[model samples]
Target chain A: MLFSFLNKSVHLHGFFETDIYSDMQKPFYVKILLVATLLLGFNAFAQETDNSSAEENGSVKAEIKEFIAHHLLDSHDFTLYTIDEENNEHFGFPLPVILWDNGLKVFSSSKFDHGQAVAEVDGEHYALYHGKIVKTDAQGTINYDEEGHATNVKPLDFSITKNVVFIIVVSLLMIFMFSRMAKTYKGNMIPKGIGRALEPIILYIRDDIAIPNIGEKHYKKYMGYLLTVFFFIWIINLLGLSPLGVNVTNNIAVTFCLAMFTFFITAFTANKNYWKHIFWMPGVPVFMKIVLAPIELLGTLIKPFSLMIRLYANITAGHLILMSILGMMFIFKSWLGSSMSFVLASALSFLELLVAALQAYIFTMLSALYFGMAVEEPEDH
Target chain B: MEKLIEQFSFGLFFWQLLLLIILLVVLRKVAWKPILNAIDERESGIKNALEAAENAKKEMQNVTADSERLLQEARMERDSMIKEAREMKEKIVADAKELAQVEADNMISQAKTAIEGEKKAAVADIKNQVATLSLEIAEKVIKEKFSEEGKQLKLVEEMVSDIKLN
Candidate 1:
């Protein structure tokens, strides 16, 4: 029965299948609540300190929203926790904050003190205002526009922020892991140890994804990209599950860039056949061909756009739901209610784990599918 | 509007692109090609082994068929040889019987002719002996009659009388 359920779930692919296991839902909710309480206790505590208002403690919906927004944004420092509330003492290392302020400004993010202080360097003052660096007085004075928005001179930020740092760390981890996995191939063809784990996924990308979608002729050329993106996304998603909260794929910029890679590859490598079909489709009426051209052109952009949005939205939503459910545990005053909240939230986190890998798979699969479409030769009708 | 613009920052996009491209190039060389090549090698090896097994099976079948055909041919040759030997033996026996019959007939005819010749010679010898014995007996009777020459004058006269009667 369990095997059948699993098979059915696998067949359903992207369908939300947590409901199908209704029998498990009770225990599932309980366990999820337990785990979510523990996890959210850690994460929520860290975030809750950002706005420790005693009067608003009872009604933290507004604070929870603020905490969630802050959690989602990329910051310059890697602040683990605050040492003292009165002193605003933070315990974390600063990453190099690279920026273009008048001229090139390269300094450690320690100058901003985890967005808690204004930084001064070379007779110029910069304030870390709400996660954006802007030119300001030591008092951090800001002039308001007519629209009542802060008008400050902001520099072009290219800092090694928390997210960027994680990206680099993950990249290095990937490189180290794959290099070891690749090294196993020198003496024996069959992989051993880490290679054993790595080989199947590689072949799956090659045989199942790449070779089938992209023809055998072109699959080799595209295999590298497919493998790279799949592992890159998969590893990043896995990292998101950790306490470090490495939500690289959740960032629109990252997803956009990844989709852009697919888009560019498809555009550059596309044969004459792909363009011909899009521009003046064969076997269709002349009027229909003319009408279809613009839509087809828009479709080119839409494909990558959807790719970007789908990954970003899915990851972001998964995190949002988990955090919200976790926040509900604090809202429930009763032990029973709070326990139930924790359990349900915990269950959702488990689902998020699946969603993380799934989102990665979907993104890679869609990208491959698009690549396949682009390089497809016209069938003789 | 400004928040949205910050999310779509050119700097982040550019960095991300640079990082991703570097990752692709690195992984393609370090990870993908080796792993993919190994898998391909293993698959092709398995295919080659299966093909070799199929060839061996086919060869075994051919060998069996050839041997079976050869065995049948040998059996047929042995059967024909046995039949010819039996026929030659029967013909030899018949020829010997016919020759024995002819020799037996010739011996019987020669034996019969010898017996006939021996019987004729024996009869001729007995006849010669009988002729001598009768002459001897006649001479003895005439001698005894003539010895009595004194009485012959009287007998001669009687004989002359008898000859006149005859």
Candidate 2:
């Protein structure tokens, strides 16, 4: 509903050719929004009655902030939701925990009891505190220093956590899909089944993204990396938006790793002219080269740094805004105020879907652009 | 802020790096290489087919034009042959008529000369017959007169007495 105008303009450009909103009429939109408003109004009124016994409003607001922070963090177990809020009983499965302490130690994450209990393996004690596995005493006591940092001896964690499981799942899904699509090409030119849907997107990346940004001569070598990163980020972002509550790209550590790959690939594959341009630019005054060298060198590192933060902040901020607006439903006591928030939240969800695809495109485009620069041939004047 | 920073774990970063590397290597080998090659081959195939079709169309047009030229030449040849045949027939008919007229004139002149000769012969024969008959009659009369010669002497004496009296 919010992006109807944007869809119209994109349709006019003849890029997509099929506008998803072209068949929808205005009355149908009004009917859907109206029904949503009525449903949200009733739900909010009921919640207002339940929360009437609360002592202060400030405490509730603080709790909401803490809840958002916890939602953004990665965890040792895959907690789908809390069934009993008072008892703190969670409904989800536990993943396998691996650690590198004195030797190899492997155990199920259920031994920690959702971070309330410590796991004992071969006479060694370990506890998951703040989503970090640390060595502790038998009583699961964590000793903190003056700065509230855990002073306990920490072991290297190689556990298969929630995020790791999704990564594996998504990777396997991609391999299965594309390999099947590739198999259809053994005898026929056109792809079959799901490949029919995926062929155009793959072609788009090849024709529009890779060939244009990375020149034809060098684009073939980098095609594997470009395709892998584009689909990986795009699929991961879509999974984050699902109700499964898996936000892998929102983690700074994950984004840092992704950016590191792009940085290393560009650095390793750069030609002689690429480095020359940085240190000693051609057709410039001698003193100007000395002054510009340091800045150009720093620019290389800063490019990937920005890439890392851009993906991380964009996803994290989107999650923050959407959650906060939904949280407003509880704070607003009247039906009118709560219903308005519900409508805003619903509209923002559609926009987030577009941002998910856009972020993937931007990351891949910039990466290809950098690779183009690194391998560019020096032309004669 | 302190707790948020604390949530950044090195283990997660390590795991992510390992998984991504594995993914890139596997996908590059199994998926991208073959798919790209197939698409490229298909595109070139389409281009070749279009060129072949265009060449065939040009050949068809050339064949039609050749047939049309041959048909026009045959029609012109047929028209001139019919004209020559008509002229030959007219000359043969006129020659036959002139020969028949010359033959008729020769026969008529020959028949007229033969008729004239026969008429002259018939006239001469009639003249000879008439002359013979006249001569026979005169001779008979002269025979009769000589028989009367004795009386002629007596008469001569009478003629002499008449001459003496004058």
Candidate 3:
């Protein structure tokens, strides 16, 4: 959100082709006073709540947690923020709910009212239970397991949820961007727009990551997958930082799929030597090789597991820390404490940006390394 | 944590897998090929250009060295030719001087022989002329003395005495 505001205001005349050259010359900080007023109002509201009863403080903390949880979860509707305080009213749009309940049920997620009300379609009831649609009646009574797990029957949901929507949007965005970049390379001219930015990264992945890990002869065969994975993770991680509250990469399902893809590619491309080294140590004793063979096989499975967990944990922790610090401004209930929180939050936000790009690099580099290891030729000691 | 794990959906995996595969294929054809090919082409082109330049420079150096050697050989040849011609000229001048001295000596000897012959012949002719004059004088005296026997006897005795003194 800050980036969009900055891009729209101060740094409009950058290498980006957002508004074209005609709108290049524009003054900076047009909305500074407006932002100041908004912050002032928020501070005043925080003070008012501070002076209120202790009961209201508890509810405020609950509201903050609820907001953070909502931000973290994948929702069927796109809610930017809540507008009204009296009744639960969100200031965003709904998405198409694709479900396989009984038959193919298609409807707008606005019927769920941001998971407040239940949606009844064709004499069947559907309720949003913890960001998952489950079959329920009008009362929306949710059944739970002995361990408090939701035992509601869930259909194979193919809904274009907020996360999926962003995925598609981001996918099309990448497609359009790289495809246009490819077109410019037809001649010997430099990339015109985002291509200029992506060129260095592409070369970096090729030189620093792909070529060095995957050898000169075999690196070309795997560049396509490596490049795609790098951009895909990097872009989604960046989008997660935006005000849209997209936590796609922070989700395990997404990370798991990415790791699985890497695993599948590595397994499929592994040469005979890779298996030989894993199952049978050449120089070691035969008994020791047999003992270590299962561990080596387990290592193959663990590699992707660690890859999935690393990305999921890193991004999720970064978001949690950032949001928690921002939530502290209200919890602090004092100007000094709130200001300190604000500073700490700003610093963390900056770190998260770095972490965002770093995680992508780490993931892509490790994937390339694994690919290289798998296809390495057998050599004498 | 359990709740978070519950967020994973099988549908999402399939969807993401399908999407990523499609992305890989499309991007490889569209993006990676052109960018890489252009770089490779430019790189090799530069290498070829540099090699051509280096070869040309070497060839030029060889040609320059060859021309310098040929020029030096020609200069040496001209120097030797001049030296030989100068030596031959000195030899011819010395031989002509020796031949002129021999001719001068022969002419002087011939002139000396002719002068000596003329002097000897002139002396002989003078002696002959003197003998004839003396015989004529004696004959005239004998004729006068026969005409007068006593004067003849006196002249004969004087002639005999003068002859005895000679």
Candidate 4:
């Protein structure tokens, strides 16, 4: 009878263990792992298929060409692969839109797309395909709508991208908050309410970032840029967390634009002292100075380039790693393994959030430091 | 080369340039200006508030000093008034004592003069009475002696001579 009881208990334990495993399978981590494993399985399947297709064609190059033709630029179903959707259309081609008096009047993508749309109010010729507002007589000039109504001015066929919208909203929010803070200061009020919360951060930037990096006299000169950068990068990084998938910082082009702006500002704002330090070292040996000139000048250019690449690579790598981890879930056939992969991926995703903000702060801080360096006076020593 | 040149037209670049210019202009006018102005205004406000606080502190100090000065003056005035009262009482008491002394002196002098006049009158009366008595005595003795002594005529003549000499 004792032996039978022990056997019964062992059976019950087995059942309980199976139940626990089944319950654990439905967690978010499990889902992520499952999705990742599936993706990997699909990738393997595709690779096998590609090999078979290549064998049939007698060339791997032919298989690759076929794959590109079918996947990349195909116009079937009137669809385009775009990173962002705008104006109810995908951004497949580089296009320009005319914005005048805060009104979008015309948009155009490529010639094959919607070629142009004439303004219904005044019959003004608007090239919707290229986002250009044109007068009938002038090549690029815009003619006003005949109707006095402003809303009739339709946005060019193109719509604002998610990234652009995010940027604009964040910029407006920053402006509003800072303006309110200014009012609080004017009223001689202690930083109460939202102002109180932001006051410490602003002070930190001034005391910790601007003062230490830029030096006292020239810090004020770069304050505008520094504040702008800090807010801009922070806002973009935050938006990256949203479901909208705004990867502005990850986009090399966007980083390039930001880096370029900093470069131009530094280049234009550099005092003679900045250049003197680079081109001619006062205390260095003559031979060394000659050798250092080219390197120092090159460093100046490389500084901004590295800033761009650093921001882009870090953000892109974070996203890619997250996606890859998630993809591993589908690649694994075992439910346990997939679940574990998902848990790891989720943890990494949480870490990515912190990294995003940290990256923005680092970028802004470094940029401010560079600006400070560019404008700093040579030390007396 | 010609086809590639045709493909890559200047128009697209021109459009990009125009967009960039517009972006810069719009951003400068709308975004940068307001942001910078807000920052400047905030700084000025903070500075002004600090100055106002300093002014208020100085004003408070002045008011405290004024109150202290007024209190000191009041204390000094109270001390002086007390001193003046004490001095007045002393002077009045001195005057009263002096007037009493003068009245006593006048009464004493009047009594002494009356006493002197009365003594003089009494002395004159006493002298007159003494003279009368002496005369009476002399007359009686002469009458008695003359009746008894005819033989004493010569002595009477000598006595008359002595009386005239006395």
Candidate 5:
């Protein structure tokens, strides 16, 4: 029943999916309320099951919190769905764990037994503790430092985690879609299939975002990176919203890497005027230049820093709030309260969908803006 | 902060960076290059087609105006030609009439002079004939008068008196 509900929601591309789900001519308000109530009910159920083993005082809330945190983290296995929580049965496939401890130590994530067992590989015992692979004894004992931090030697992990899988999938999907779109160009000027839907978006990035932000002369140079980043984040964000539990952009590591790309590109491609304005303010008072130079320099670093934090925080907060709202249904336990929470959660989900695209657009737009500033030709007044 | 720091995996960052670079490179070669080129080509194609259409429209207008001007010029030329022909015909007719009047006047004057000369000659010839007849008659009368001296003397006296009275 739960799987079917999730499947129906997954197939819902937009809000106009009432006719597909039901034959009855329900009013729009009732649909909204029904969707909200359903979301609340699902959240309550998820909370109940996830917190079943840890049913201590106020355990549902704590479980929901843990669930949100777990959702935020990158995992070794891609858990598609939970079959039986008590029995620890998850209906998904394990990913390959690639680690470099002294030398290469490759193994399947299933060897860790969902982080409950220690795996002995080539006479070396290792355990999964808090989503990190650590060196442990036969008993899988994890030593802690005075600060309660793990003191166990961590292997240099390069595992194909859940997020990595999604990354690979999304990238490959992008290549397939665009290659097919490009192939259609050989036949006629008008695009078809995925190209038809994606062409306008590409043009929007080119005309509205890239060309406007990055001037036409220099826009084409940055189109590859801009287009890639835009669609990458957009698609990743959209996937994150799905029940598939692929919250990639929410990962600080991922966002940090993305921001660094923009930063490095700006730093590398910046013209002389950009540095002049940063390090030594041109067309300014000498005293003011000394004061403003440091600020300007700091601004350059802060720009990408903010870019990283903005995307990470927005996506993470979105997930947190959504999970929390859904979790609220469990605490409410009443029809009215559960329904309200569900409605709020449902509305937020729609908002999140808008945000998914909006964040991508903003990131691309800002990156182009930074590139524009970097390569801007100084005006002669 | 400690947990956050612990959660920060250099491995994840490295992998993300590496994968992103790979994605960027691969996508640039595969997706972006072609899609952008196609879009630009289509845009320029549309622009060129529109410009051609605009030029064709303007050319059509120009051709229409040119044909209209040609028609007007032909009409004007035809009108001038017809006017010139009419003027030439009228001038020729007037010149022929003037020449005919001068020739007719000359012939009439010549005929009048000839008539005057013929009348004078006829009158002179009749007077001469009359004079001859009168002389002949005079001779006969003289002869008869001589036979009859009294009648002759009376005719001579009458002639003498007629002459003295003239």
Candidate 6:
């Protein structure tokens, strides 16, 4: 019965592979190419299955799992993981993730099976592996081991999972850049070195962006936020160019956080003039203001939402297109077609890198604009 | 699954809020204030230097104008002194010429008077000599011609003189 099952699996794999290859030749070449590659990969595994014994198959699977676990969870490589020698274990635990509300959430290989090491402290449940706050759970519960050691159950940290390493790296880079700029200012020299490159961009944000939109009087209050947004977006966009497979800014939640910051700042800092224009709107008919009040309030909510969608959609689409093109290589199975696809994909990836920085700049610039509008004093006609 | 999403567990939110507050406070203290202060100081320094330069320029202009006025006054004083000296020299020269002419005229008049007095004296002396000679000659001739008639003529002359006196 086992033999028949293996044979059927092989037959199915071959059938799918053939279908994928045939599809590659169709008019929708790029799509066919991606499907074909995935199908062919399955077929190759099946072919290997025919020659290898069950024991060998089990060992191969074990090796693959071990490779993923060691690299992702144990902090073996520098790209995706950071090792803490003091803790003797990875810092954060990797949780099993299904889907996120805004995007796909998966456990980072950093903290695998670390749900076993959590502890409850003062009525609050915390994943306490090596004395750090690993994850916080909703309800307090202790899952005891066979030896009666208490294991803490907790909800996963979704923030770090999607692209924790990426976020960290980009944030450090931005802090470093801004810190250097501040130091240069203290030294009383026109910022030389890295400061030279960053100065014009900072000035552009202050002059062309913040002052024009926010008005001169209130622009100073929002300068800190505008600067933070500009650098944050720019740094994340730069990281997307690397081969580390980090796409933090592509997630809508990240964009939403940035937009919400702008919203809060504008709302809090708004003068009487801003609220007056929204509720009363000078020189307009009384009926018109009544009609416009709800619309204006709705617009305030929609502005941030639009900012979130625009950044998320552009970055996500760029990554998807690039990945799909790369997948085309295995699909075509023809050297000519695969080579052409690679060239096209590589060119597109380089273009996407430019787009990443551009998108970041656009998002930051737009948020500043919205802030400017919110706090803007009405013109004295 | 929907129930899980709906549950409001304050624990995670509290932690995040705490972290956000901490970040804001720390960043504001460590990074923002010092940087803004430095910029402000630099701007003020530049403004002060520019104002000082403008003040110095004004002072220099005022000094230049003052010196020019002083130089003009000095020049005018020197010109008036030169004019006064020239007029005094002309007056002294004219007085000296008039005194010399008066002395020359006085000497000429004195010499002329002395010469006229001497001529008059000399002519008077000649006339006296001529009268003496003529008287002597007439006495000699009278003595020779009529020694005997002299007593009678003397008497007749005395008689005529007496008649004439009467």
DockQ of each candidate relative to the true complex: 0.28, 0.28, 0.24, 0.01, 0.26, 0.05
RMSD of candidates 1 onward, in order: 8.5, 10.1, 11.5, 17.5, 10.6, 13.5
Candidate 6: C-alpha RMSD after superposition? 13.5
Ranking by lDDT: 5, 2, 3, 1, 6, 4
lDDT at residue A187 of model 6 (Cα atoms):
60
C-alpha TM-score for every candidate: 0.79, 0.76, 0.76, 0.56, 0.79, 0.59
lDDT of 4 by residue, A1-381 (tens): 223434544553453344321232236346644555556554555556565643543343333333222221112012234443334365444433433424554443243243333333234444331222233322323445576322223332233333444445666676666666655655454655676776666667777888888788877766666666666676677666665455556644456667777788888988888898789967899998998788778778777766766676577667655654555554453465568778988898888888887887787787787888788776623
For residues A1-381, write the lDDT of model 5, one tens digit per residue.
223333433443232233311222134225535655666654566457666533542577566656766777899998987788788898999999998987898999999878888999888899998788999999999999897888999889999999989988888888888888888888588988988899889888888998877787888889999999999999999999998968999877888899999999999999998898888878889998998877777678777766776787678768877876787677656677678878989999999999999999889998998999899888722
Predicted candidate 3 versus true structure: per-residue lDDT over A222-261, tens digit per residue:
8888888898898999889887768888777889989998
Clashes of 5: 0
lDDT of 6 at A12: 39
Kindly provide the TM-score of model 5 when superposed on the true structure, using C-alpha atoms: 0.79
Supply the global lDDT for candidate 2. 0.79
Worst 10 residues of 5 chain A by lDDT: A16-25
Worst 10 residues of 3 chain B by lDDT: B1-10
Candidate 4 scores an iRMS of: 14.5
Question: Could you give the fnat of all candidates in order?
Answer: 0.66, 0.66, 0.59, 0.00, 0.59, 0.07
lDDT of 5 by residue, B29-69 (tens): 87788778877888899999999999999999999999999
Which docking band does candidate 2 fall into?
A: acceptable
Q: Give the number of the best model, judged by lDDT.
A: 5
Output the better candidate (2/3) by DockQ: 2
